[model samples]
Target: MKRWKIAGLFAMALMVSAAPFQAFATSPEFAYTAEKWASLRDNKLEYGEIADLIHEYNTTVRQNELDYQEYKGKTSTDIAEEYYDSANEVSERIRYPDDDSANYANQIASALNSEISVTNLTEQGDSNVDDGEIKRLGYEQQEKNLVQQAQKLMISYYSGKASLATLEDAVTQAETAYTQAQTRKAAGMALQSDLDTAAEAVTNAKASLQSAKSSLEQTKQQLIIMMGWNYNDSVEIGSLPDVDTSVVSKINVTSDIQTAIANNYSVKITERRLANSQSENNRATYTNTLANQKETVSTNVKNAYNSLVLAKDSYDQAKTSYDLAEKERAAAELRLSAGTITKKTYEKQESACLSAKTSMETAKLSFLTAQVTYDWAVAGLASVS
Candidate 1:
């Protein structure tokens, strides 16, 4: 009802920042304007606009890979030719030496001349060494990393937008508090000091709101810069893309760990890198290094899952409190009907119930945010909801 005997929102509302988010269909999440969502769905984004940037990135990386191969091949050919030129060179001093020294110099030059063949010199200083191959492989891996990074940025941008909704709600509540205090003071029921405190709260709430807008703007601009778009400050994005919650029920920690280890962009790149090695030992080294990376990825998944568990627990506690607030509110309503309590006290109880509801919603958002993060870590965006 938003009715309250108090002139201001309880201390709890100002002390705690409510985060707007929804983890599942039943979870509480912030709602966005249709216009904003339309912008995101439309062509407002410049870089990696269509979900994953893998295909476009692959095209650029492939072209660079070809150019790298050409450059390495040319360098190797140049080095081989330099070897041939060295073997063919003769010393001008060979003619002026003592007979024995001159003979020895002539013999040494003759041997180098005899070995002046492409195949023989190339064998000693092969341009097709593992170094060039490894270099190209590294380039490929770097491109893949960029794509993965873009995906993470996409997730972060949407998550921040959700918080913006919470800030907007906070601003409204603060303004409401200030208005109520002014009304109370006019009737001599509230002190000037109380009015001033509410006014200060409104100011703080507005400042926080502005800060949130600026942050969202910064995130949107980052996407434009990364995707090679013209500098634009007025990018509008809609609601977060929905996660595939169906997979949440299918998460197999062991299987997911295996998938991340085997199919992670880096792991796949390193596996391909085995072909870049010239010997068995080098191939084994690459294999072992990538294999060892599995543990780290598994740990990340577990950590994210642990956070989700904690968030769920918090949500449960909030639900219990909300239920208790509902009971208290019902009791107050009955007392008011029986003429056993003042109307102002009943209204206060109603306000407390509303506050409890808001807290419960905030907890729901927290739970959803944690769920999304955990799903992304273990099963990726495809599996997240």
Candidate 2:
């Protein structure tokens, strides 16, 4: 009997240990398990996965989604029915002559009042309003905003990396120039001022590189946290996909403006309010507000398109500059092979080419950001007035 009791106790403990996992598997509250979250933390995070991450892990997005899910298919009438049931329950309890009779009476009164209020509101409120859909859209917009933020941070982080590389090259070039200056000065071929300038360049280059590194790390931290990871969590960040320059040619500004106005969440909300307005004055006010909102959305889309155009132009110019730098670098390499230029001169040319490449990359990132903004505008996710 003692061994059987011990075995039963062990089985009970095992069941207790497994209960939480069983609950988690069946629970509607959690869309992901702890194991899933752990897997996400372990895997490399990519730019394309930001939207899904935000939906799954962002606190605000998760709360909104849960709220929407709870209220889905539940109308004001359903809420009023719930209130009526509470009132009826209180009334039933009041029939019993208990010591808390007076308190139960007050509770019944309050419940009845609440039920009446909800019923009246339901009768007067917009009959066509789908609260669930509105909440779902709100949740979607939150996720979109977070994803956009992550994209911007990712772009800045990669751009900073490119700039850091260019700075590192610049420092090497500066050190080489300083060494050559010292050699020339010793031979009475260069001035002390030249050596001083070279040393200053090296110092400035190192300082810039250090500052860039700090800024990049801060950006990475923000991006990681935004994607549902702890600020200091170590994870590999994948590269941004190549920008689709072809999208630029596909944009139709006029059509896009209409699509933006139609799909804008704020505009939809305002229209709903206008539809539910009881008084003529309230209706007119909301009407005017809705018109203003549509106009603002249109302007935002136009501005985003213009910005994209300017970014593309700048990118093109940078690409031209980079192409010229590449040719010059290639020519310098040939000259070095022929012993026509000193190693210091070749290294300086190499640094210049790197700088040009960094500039081109930075320009491309700017254009990509602009492209994303325009896309968001058309998708009704951009910032309106």
Candidate 3:
């Protein structure tokens, strides 16, 4: 989102600060939705304040990479060091007689299992090689997924705000129209039926406004839960920021699937299980399951990508329709003002424009959700072993 747009949003919140809002509490914390949304999106954004957590994560990842690199470098430059005591075990097994050889083999096996000897000293032998990487990736992906969740929630929050605002305006308009209709009817210029219809419009608009408010509150709770905050906090969300679609272009289906196969947590877990399993049947089962998992991961990525593409297409179509409706709405407003069209006709055109915009936003939300999910599945914790 542009800085100016964000500034404008805050400005709007400041404008509405004086309004009497009856929420669940009386505290004047973020009475406007824009203020709360901006806090969640920026100031109090999840993981932002927890620099220690991110620092720990980076430290761990860096150390693991260094360890892996050290292991690789040692293998390349110091073949003698690599083969030392671990390679001696193979010779020791053959050098011993039957009984001694068997006992020594058992001892060596126990040592290797316990990580107490030089038998399993390579990077492949170290459990931390996979474990460390997986943990770090999981943490990084979790933060990303949360942000994606926040983005969708933010969009919905703004949608709810718009609906509520629109309905509130409608209620006021309907009430004024109703009062005018009643006055005109008394003067014999308008019928009782006209007054009744205007009164009903007011009732309907008020009901819609209430419904919109309720929806907004529900979403607020969702955002609160996501940020690990108290639900009763003053959480008036700000305007929805635009999603960065540049990430989408970076996603490669083939490369991502390969990455998932090599790194996915489930795949890595299953691989570890297969490696550690003593039974031939159990190993075969885990291997088959892992194979199936690879296929599933591939399918999920493909499906999510497809969904995003379809959503973008849908948004394009919706936006085109909205643009045309906006033009119609403008003409309707002019016609109504000129007394060439009825107020109802003007309202219908206005509603068409609003509905079209809502549809476009809905499509945009779907695309972003799919984009986030796909990114997680292919590159993040979902993909790491």
Clashing pairs in 1: 21-29, 23-368, 37-238, 47-227, 243-384, 243-385, 244-384
- Candidate 1 per-residue lDDT over residues 1-385, each given as its tens digit: 1111110132233224332212111111123356533433343543334333232223354345444543343443454456556444522222343556747787766555555543455554443333444445456555655555555565567656656655666777788789999999999999999999999999998999898788867777776445434357344443444433344456676776666555454555555556555568767887787666656667777777667677777877888998999999999999999999998688668767776776776666666667656655553322211
Better of 1 and 3 by TM-score: 3
Error of 2 at 86 (Å): 17
**lDDT (Cα, tens digit) per residue for candidate 2, span 1-385:** 2222332343354345443222111222245577654445454678877776665556566445435545555654454455556555644544333556768777666666766665555454423343544555666676778788888888888888878888788777778778888999999998889889988998998898889899999999888777667777776889888976778888889999999988887888777667655568768888999999998998889999999999998999999999999999999999999999998789878888888999999999999999888888888775657
TM-scores for all predictions: 0.51, 0.72, 0.55
In what order do the candidates fall by TM-score, top score first? 2, 3, 1
Better of 2 and 3 by TM-score: 2
Model 1 residue runs over 4 Å out of place are 1-148, 180-192, 233-239, 244-246, 268-288, 301-385
How many Å off is the CA of 254 in candidate 1?
Answer: 2.3
Top-lDDT structure, candidate number: 2
Lowest-lDDT window of 10 residues in candidate 1? 20-29
lDDT of 2 at 103: 87
- C-alpha lDDT of all candidate models, in order: 0.56, 0.73, 0.58
**Candidate 3 lDDT trough over 10 residues, lowest sum:** 20-29
Local error of candidate 3 at 272, Å?
A: 2.3
